[model samples]
Each structure stands twice: as structure tokens, then as C-alpha cells.
Target: MPAMRFFVFALSLAVTSPLLAEEAKPGSPPPERIVEQKIPPLTPPDHELDLLFAQLKKERNPQAARLIADRITSSLFYSGSATVDMLMGNARKATEEKRFGAALDFLDQITLLAPGYAEGWNARASLHYQMGNFPKAMADTAHVLKLEPRHLGALSGLAAVLSQSGRDQQALAALEAYLDRYPADRDAQKRAIDLMIKLDGQRT
Candidate 1:
């Protein structure tokens, strides 16, 4: 499969500030440690899945929603561009509903259907990271880097996953690589700096 590129450049990390590297204040525990959590895949494509998509699009009528989404998917599957977008849309809807497992499944489908689409892999990586599956997330990010060497999103994702996984040095390196390519990425740069300090303090 082709490398998956990240959408880091398109993401707004400012929405959530990065945690600094300082020691936790007195009486406070360190940041919560995240571990990989295995999630079972949802049932294969069905009328209910189509209805869910339609409901997400503001369609109130269940019957109509299922019909429309099914029709769209039928035509979308054969076209790479459309298929990617369709799958992405479904993933987004699943995420909005806090259905992380389903979102991952949708992303998985995207990768299977359109392995060459950098965006598909990137999206999958994001979902995996959100689920605390750092190893899987990192692997997907690497795939993105292979497809687009300068993908800021993948670089940032790699950095985040590495930091969380206790591979701070590697994370710092990935972040530095991203900053070198995007000098104006103040948010990402700040995150990298904060994570570096945090990791360094751990060593000291």
C-alpha cells in the first residue's frame, strides 16, 4: 500500500493546548497514561449504516435517508475520489457521535478501498491515536510519510504518538522535521517545544 499522508496542516491544534513539560503540581498525578484498546468492528455495510449516514446529513426520514445514502455509496465505490470523500464523510459522522470504533472501521474501509489515497490513511491514523492505539497510529503515520514525505500532519501525529509512548527523543525529532518544513506552524512548534521539555525533565 502507498504511504498515507497526514492532514496536520489542515488541523487546528490551537483548539487544545499542549501539555507543558513541568512537573505536576503538588498532589497531582502525572498525565494519564494511555494504552492501546482493541475495538471490535461493527457489522458490515447494511441499511442501518446507510440510515446513520443520512441521519447525520440532517435527513429525518429513516427510509429516505437509507435509500439516499445507499445510492450514493453504490455510485461512489467505483470512483476513487468520490469513494474517499464518501468514506471520510461517514467517518466524520461516526466521530461526531462518539463512535470511535465505528469511525476506525470506516477509516479501515477507506484504506482498503483506496490505499493510494493519502488522506484515507491519515484519517485512520488520527482515529487510532484518539483511541490510544499509539503503535497502530504511528504505523499509519509512517505510511502517510511514505506517500507524502513532507506531510506536516503525519509528522505531528508521529510526534504525539511517540511522546505518549515514552519515545520522547524520537517524537522531538519528528516534530523538528515538521517545523523545518513549516516555519510558520507556530502551534506545532510550540507543541514540540513543550513535549521536549516534558521529556527532558523525565530524564533529569
Candidate 2:
């Protein structure tokens, strides 16, 4: 099998451990620790998303496309409720602190409080992915897509889940769809190409 590149949300950190790094033993080297942190993106005005999406579709410049995609992502985080936003912030902080359970709790409240908010589902999906709960991550991703079919993060996430499950064909299709919406995503484009080659080789 070809090496697969996993995708995570730009706004999220990829946490590999739920515990803090242990102190180095006497005369031993310190353990290397990887910590992932998430920076909450600003929520752009609702009226600007349409224009931003349009620009994203037509943007060929990598830098410009990234800017447009960031703007679109920002809008996705808008829940229109202060309470939900606060809960989401707490979830982010919890995740950063490696308090996965507490993060999940905050995420659960956010999802329940704003079931219509796609970001709530998206956030939970990211946490699940980080926790190696692919099934739950995929389920939350499905909810995100149902709420917002054009969600770039959800599309990429679905591809990641499918790829992890050994469903390369489905992953390729999902990634292609993501590229169709955001062509300037170089990483997704590369993954899509890799999948195409792998599948084509299987046909021979």
C-alpha cells in the first residue's frame, strides 16, 4: 500500500498523547514531547462568505487561495450564541491541555446547545480524530457535511477517515470533491494524485 498523508483541520492541533511529558530520568535524555494547540479562527461576517467562497473557487494563487479558505473557515465557526462559543472555547483549551475527556464534555454541550451549528460537529469530529476514534470522527463528520455540504474541513476529514479505514477509493472521491471546492489546497491535490495512481495500478 502507498503511504497515506493524513489531514487535520488547519484550526486544530494533532494531539498524539493525553498525558504530559515525563521528566527525564537521571543521566538520561529528556523525552521528546509533541504538543498540538488550536487557534480559534475569527468569524467573518455572514455576508462576506459568499464573496469569499466565490473567490476561493476561482483563486489560482496558492497564497490568495489560502487566505480565502481561511476566511471561509472563520465563518464556519460562527454559532451566533455566546454560550456555545464559550463552550467551544473551553473545548479548545481542554484539547490543548491534553484533557481529552474534558474537551469531549465541552464539545458535547456545544453540540447539544447548537445542534444546527456545523462547527460544533466539526470540532467534535476533530477531537475524535485526535483521540483515534475514527468511527465517531466519521459520524460527526457526516453530521457536519449534512449541515454544510460545502464545508472544506469536513470533506478533507471524511477523506482521512476513509483512507485510515483502507477505503482508498472513497477517500479519493472525497478528496477530489474537496479539491474541486478548494483547488489551491496543495496537500489535498497531492493526496488525490497519489490515490489516483494507487487505484490505477490496482486495475492492471
Candidate 3:
């Protein structure tokens, strides 16, 4: 009986020995230690921007989308050239989502970070138009034109916002200016013709 009991005890030790060895091994790190070693830090225009962009893509709510876009744009500004496309993409996404506030914030960062970027001011102006801030939109558009005289989008955006705000005469002038620069732009030509008719009707 004692021999049998001793045999049983030895069998139990043999069965548990591997687990004990695993627990006692100095070369093997603990689970928590392993996790800490593998974890990475959050950096600008990469991890943080990636997360924000994912949220923007998934969230249908404009406010939530705007918040994430703002965060991404702000964070990405520090990454230099790597961030230019990312910032522009985020701004465009925000605009498409109709999150004007977020788009404006992103554009603001662009102007501060890359002041010479014509698209930045143009995009901000477009955002202002979407937000119904006509005066501010016109101002921004004007700046874009000054920086890049042949910027079709800025001219068209100015015309659109002017027409929306009952400044048909100015809108017509802006459209003409755009047509002068982009004579081959069939869309701009068509828009100019439409604006001229509208202005004539308003005058009559």
C-alpha cells in the first residue's frame, strides 16, 4: 500500500513538472513583461492619425467625424512632408462628410504649417462657403487667387459663394475671371454663361 501511495505521488509530480518548469524559467519573460516589451508608442501622422481616420471612416455622425479629423490634422502637422497628403486627405474627408468646422481646423493647420500651399486656402474657402460664411469664404478665396492666380477651384468657389449670398454681379466677375484663365474648362464656361443669364435677369 505504501509503495502504491509513493508511486501515485511520483506520477502526480511528473504530470505537473512541465508547468512548474515553465513558471520557474528565468529566460522566459512573464506575460506582462512580454506585453510591455512588444507595445509601441503612439506617434503623429501614423498611429494617432490612423486611428482617427478609421474612426472618421466608420462614424456616420458629423460631429464625431469632425472631432476625429481635427485631432488627426492637428497631430499630423508636426510630421512635415509625410503629413501633407495625410492632412489634405483628412480635410477632404471632413469636407465630404460636411463637417465644415473640422475642415476649417485642418485648413488652418495647413496654412500655418505650409503657408504657401494654395490648396490649403482654397479648401478653407470652400469650407466657409459650405458653412454659409460667405464673407470669410470670399476673403480666403481671394487670398488663394493672390497666391495662385490661375487656381480654378478658388475662382469657382468664390463665384459660387458670391452668387449664393446675392452678390450676383461679383459672382459674374469671378466666373469671367475663371473663364479667362481656364478658357478650355467647359464646365467653367457653362457656369459663366449661367451666371451671366442670372445676373441679367436680376438686373431686369
Best of the candidates, lDDT: 2
Tell me the TM-score of each prediction against the true structure: 0.58, 0.76, 0.56
Over 4 Å off, model 1? 1-80, 198-204
Ordering by TM-score:
2, 1, 3
- Model with the higher lDDT, candidate 1 or 2: 2
Backbone Cα, N, C clashes tallied per candidate: 5, 0, 0
Clashing pairs in 1: 4-143, 4-144, 5-144, 8-153, 21-198
Q: Enumerate residue pairs that collide in model 3.
A: none
lDDT of 3 by residue, 92-122 (tens): 9988998878877888987787666666777
Among all windows of 10 consecutive residues in model 1, the one with the lowest summed lDDT is 1-10
On TM-score, the leading prediction is 2
Estimate every model's Cα lDDT from 0 to 1. Answer: 0.64, 0.80, 0.63
Local lDDT at 4 for model 3: 35
Per-residue lDDT of 87-170 in model 2, one digit per residue for the tens? 999999999999999999999988786677889999999999999999889889878876776789998998998899898987
